[model samples]
Target chain A: MRFDVTILGSSSATPIYNRNPTAQALNINERFYLIDCGEGTQQQMLRYDIKSSRIDYIFISHLHGDHYLGLVGLLSSLNLNGRKKPITLFGPAHLKDIIQMHFEYSETTIQFDLEFRATDPSKSEIILDNQDITVETILLDHRIACTGFLFRQKRRLRKIIKERVEELQVPVEYYAVLKRGVDYFATNGQVYPNNELTTAAEEPRAYAYCSDTLYNESYFEQIAGVNLLYHEATFAHDMLDRANETHHTTALQAGEIAKITGAKKLLIGHFSARYKTLTDLLDEARSVFPETELAIEGKTFVIES
Target chain B: MRFDVTILGSSSATPIYNRNPTAQALNINERFYLIDCGEGTQQQMLRYDIKSSRIDYIFISHLHGDHYLGLVGLLSSLNLNGRKKPITLFGPAHLKDIIQMHFEYSETTIQFDLEFRATDPSKSEIILDNQDITVETILLDHRIACTGFLFRQKRRLRKIIKERVEELQVPVEYYAVLKRGVDYFATNGQVYPNNELTTAAEEPRAYAYCSDTLYNESYFEQIAGVNLLYHEATFAHDMLDRANETHHTTALQAGEIAKITGAKKLLIGHFSARYKTLTDLLDEARSVFPETELAIEGKTFVIES
Candidate 1:
């Protein structure tokens, strides 16, 4: 299975020239999960050719304008396009009221089913579960209530060896049992070992998203050993003091977290408007964690297990 | 005086991909007056190089999202940029409350003063008057209480013939009277005719903006003979029935209004998302009024007297 993450935006609180606000899209199998819809997110999605209709769920970190300002516009566009599928939105409780008031004032009634699920930003909890993937939230320290997410894909069954099964005189109907790691039994009470015909199942892949939070070690244990980790590094090491004062993480801090958590690869973004070029940020992060990569806009990074 | 009008966005209700919402920047001399800040208006301003700091006042047509969704974001950006000049906003009574609520909820105390003036959308009235320009609202027929605006530049001083003034032995202080089209009196009591020294001031330029309204001839009298007129054209001629039902105007209707009012030129926009190409819309409007032009994004149409 091919799983990947796409960066829609990488800017922090302020919008700059050619840099959009925070938004990302996770592609698991053939499905898409959108996260953190900032202003103009729908337009960015349109420009990147991401089918808006394929999005089944949206995960919002907080109520800041840069994190969720584009949500209402995206929903309005979806309704105008005649979307009928139900979309689940996970965010804070106040988000529902804000969205409702705007629609009420505009007298707009959406055509699709919208489900709002309030997430507690203080603790870790399972938010979504399916046969293919499981999503959980991890609390992070910030000025406001904020949470990160961990998405883990389920392991696939091992493939059976056709020649071995045939040499053992196994029937075609018994292939399901062999693929399930079970031994096939003959009618005469003869047994066939499962290890001879099948290999081990593939390991599950994991991806984590952390946005707009101060550097705190409490989340390291929860997201440890993630295959791909995306964390917001709003400032460089030179502004570490300012980052602490403003409840943001510096590039070095993000790299430290990635190092402590033993993540396979680190993706750092959510850049401040002051930095015109990201060369310093990449250099800072790479010095601490050699596997760190800059989250460039419109680029996709595949998660490999 | 160099006075011109630029159409930034011209979409109603919902904003489409290429078609932006309602926003226009009127430039008179060195000052800028922004009218109707729709969603993405600030981005449009940046795209066209319209200085946000030069905007002295903002006029909103109504409370519709397509008309005012961009106001909060724009104001926030201004605050982020540390703008100190007070921004005067003229709109309906409820707009102040809505903006206050958003600020209060976000715990943001604006750094600059925001002067709010309520306009009766149902009646025509003078909204703003300054040394360089005067603005008046014209009642528009829409599903909601909405109003359009007429911007007229104040008459400038007549040019003085330097050699003629020198020959008359007129004092420098008396040049003001000559520019104002008045006869100057010398110390010897000799009368200097105003026409010989100065010509008449250039005719004042005028531009009108009509947005999200149905075809109504009553507005024609108020905005008559405008140098440039921008009218909403939400649909093509074939959708005239639908346009009437939805309180919108077709391209033909916009051209008819321009022809009836004897406007010098007509600019048509506010396209429906259903149409991918605007060639037919331009053709339809030009068929009725030959001087009609389509409102292209980032293009400025100067209002010449």
Candidate 2:
């Protein structure tokens, strides 16, 4: 199964010089999840050829305009396009009011079910769990209510050795139990060890997205050991003062977070518009975390275990 | 003085296929007036190189998402850029509530003043009358409370003939009165005719913008003889039934309105996503009104009297 993230937009606050605001598309085993849909996210999706219908869940990190401004428009467009599947939205408590107010004033009746789950910014909460993955919200430090999301793939069952099972004459009904690591007891009172019948499955992988937050270590333990980490690097190390004043993370700070969380790879984005080039920020990040990479738009980053 | 309009966005309803939604920037003597800022309008402005700081007045035709969805983002971006100049907003009464609700939830403090004028969609009203122009709202036929905007340039003063005035020995103090069409009286008790002292000023120009509306003639007299008229043509003549059902205008209907109102030129836009190419709609409009033109994005149309 494919597990990758596509960058839709990377600009911070304002979309300037052709760089769009914060938005990313995460594909976990073909199901899509959108994170931080800023303005022009729909267009960005179109530009990148990402189908909106595949997106079943949307996670908004904060109420900031750069983080969630594109949500209403995206929802409206989905309704217009005759989307009927229910969509799960995870965000702050006030997001429901904002979306409802827009629909009320415009007299627009949404054509699909919108399931909303409000996230608490003060604690780590499990927002969703499915057969494919489990999603948890990690509280982050920001000017307003903001939280990051952690996606961990579900553990797969052990793969049964078909040759060993057939040679041992294991019944078809007992195949599923064998895959679950249970010993097989034949009708003739013969016992078969699970380890001899099956092999271990691949390890589950995890990815975390952190954006529009200050350099705080509150959520470090929650997202520790993530395979892939996307953190907002809105400023360079030289502009650390501005980053603190605005409650945003600098490139160096983002690198430190990756190092502390023991993330295998760090993907940094939410670049400030002042930096026409991002080499300085990337270098600053790499100085701390050698596995850091810039989150370039339209590029997909795969998470590996 | 410059009297031109730059088409920032021309698509209707939702943005699609690289064509943006409805948005236009009118430059009247270097002052910018924004009409119907749809989604991605600020980015459109940047793409067309239209400065947002010059926009002092914004007129929203209705509460439809395609017409006003970009307003909050644009306003927030302006504030973020340290804009301190007050901007006048003309829209529905509920717009202030929506904007305030967003600010309250986001905890954002605007750096500039946003003066709002509630427009009554049921009747024609004079929304603004400044020294440079007079803005009047024209009631439109739509599913929601919608209105069109009519912008008329304020009459200019007659130009004074400096050489004629010097030869005629007119006092410097009388120059102002002479430009107001008053006869100049010299110290010798001889009256110089106002016609000979100065030339008549150019006729005032007018432009009208109508979007998300149906075929209606209620504002015919109000927008008659406008130099430039931009009407929404969301459908072609063949799709007249759909246009009527959606309370939108067809290309032929829009052209008929321009012709009936005696507008010097007609610009048709707000094209539906169904139209991959606008040749059919443009041909239909041109067949009705010979002076019709398509409202192409990034193209500027000059209005002359």
Candidate 3:
């Protein structure tokens, strides 16, 4: 199974110069999920050759312009392209109304089923579940209603030893049962041990995304031991006062969060436009969490299980 | 007086390749007016070096995502930049409610006044007037409420012949009145004719912008003999049926509009993504109207008086 995160836009608050606002694409297996569509996100996708049609789910953290301003445009483009597959959107309660109002004014009847699921920003809850993975919402500390997302892949069945199965002449129909660790009993009264026939399944991987929030430990337990974690580092530690006032996390604080959560790797982004170069912010985060990387636009980070 | 239009984005419905959706910046005597801000408009403005702070008025043609999806992001950027000057926006009635709702949900209290003037798409009316110019709405035929804008520079005061005024020894205090084509009366009772003191002001220039509209001749009378005209040419004559079905204009129809309106120059934009090369569309328009030009992104068209 392939799981990866692609950076679309990383600038915070305002898009300036080459850096765009916050937006990312998470590829789970073959399914694409969009996170926080800021302005110019569609353009970013186009620039990076990410197929918009592959996206089946969109997760928005809040109602801030820099967070979800590009959502309407992306939806409109999808409709114009004649998309018919249903798309599930998870966000604040007001997002549905806002998207609907624009469509109503434009007299555009979307050609796809748009399902909206409102998330409670004040509590942690499982928002989505399927055979492949489960998604939970983590309440974030921001000025307005906001929530982060934690994606956990489901445990897979054990891999069968193809040569051993063939030598034992096991029936094809029993492969599913065999993978589930059931010992096979032959019609001749011979027993085949499950451990000898199969190897253990790979451990499920987990990824977490946190943005536009202050440094708070309330949600740390939910995201602890995540294989990959993406957190907003809008400012350096030197601007800690401003970050606190704005309810935004500094790079140092983001590093501390990663360290506390025991994340395997930390991706830091949402850089302020004021910082032309992000070397200082990256260094600050690496000082606390050694496994830190900057979320450069168009770069993809793959998670290994 | 400087009167020019800068093409920000030129694609019709969906942004593709190097072309974005519809967005333009119209500069009239240094005052900037943004018209039809599509997605990625702020980036386009930066690419063209059009100062967002200089834009005091915004005119939206309709409620289509390609026309107004970028407005909120632009407004938010301005607020984040600490803009204090009030911005007047002219659009459909629902636009105000939509903008207000987003702000409310984000808990953002804008630092500047955002005045909204609702324009009735069914009527032709003067929407804005000041010492510099007058803007009138031209009802356009489209799927939803759509209107074009006709900008006419206000009648200018005659430019005084400085050398002649100095030779006549006209009093400094009387120069203001002399520029108004009034005959100068000396304190000694000597009269100087207005023609000798000043030359007639350059003919007031006019520029009309019609976008995302069908081929309708109803508004031609209001825009006759305009110095410059920008009309949507979403398709060529071959796709005329598609253009009609979508309530958009073909290149041939746009050219006919330019010819009938007696516009000095015609700028055809809002190109469909179907056409990888617009040479054929340009030729089609030029065959009907010789003074036709393509509205290439990042290009500026000056309206000569």
Can you rank all candidates by lDDT, best first?
3, 2, 1
Model 3 vs. true fold: TM: 0.97
Candidate 3 has which clashing residue pairs, if any?
Answer: none
CA-lDDT, candidates in order: 0.86, 0.91, 0.93
Q: What are the per-residue Cα lDDT tens digits for candidate 3 across A122-166?
A: 788999998889999988999998999999999999899999999
> DockQ (Cα-based) per candidate?
0.46, 0.70, 0.80
lDDT of 2 by residue, A1-305 (tens): 68999999999988887789999999998999999899889989988999998899999999988888889989998998899999999999999999999999999999999999999887797899998899999888888889999999999999999999889888899888888899988788878789999998888999999888899888899889999999999999888889999999999999999999899999999998898899999999999999999999999999988
- List the candidate numbers ranked by DockQ, top first: 3, 2, 1
| Higher-DockQ candidate of 2 and 3 | 3
Tens-place lDDT per residue, model 1, A145-197, is 88889999987787888788878777889888788889878777988788888
In candidate 1, list every pair of residues with a backbone clash. Answer: B10-B270
For residue A220, model 3's alpha carbon misses the true position, in angstroms, by 0.9
**Docking outcome class, model 3:** high
lDDT by residue (tens digit), candidate 1, B19-137: 78778888888788888887677778877888887888999887777788778878888887888999999987878877886676566789999999998976898888899888999
Fraction of the true interface contacts (Cα pairs closer than 8 Å across chains) found in each model: 0.16, 0.57, 0.81
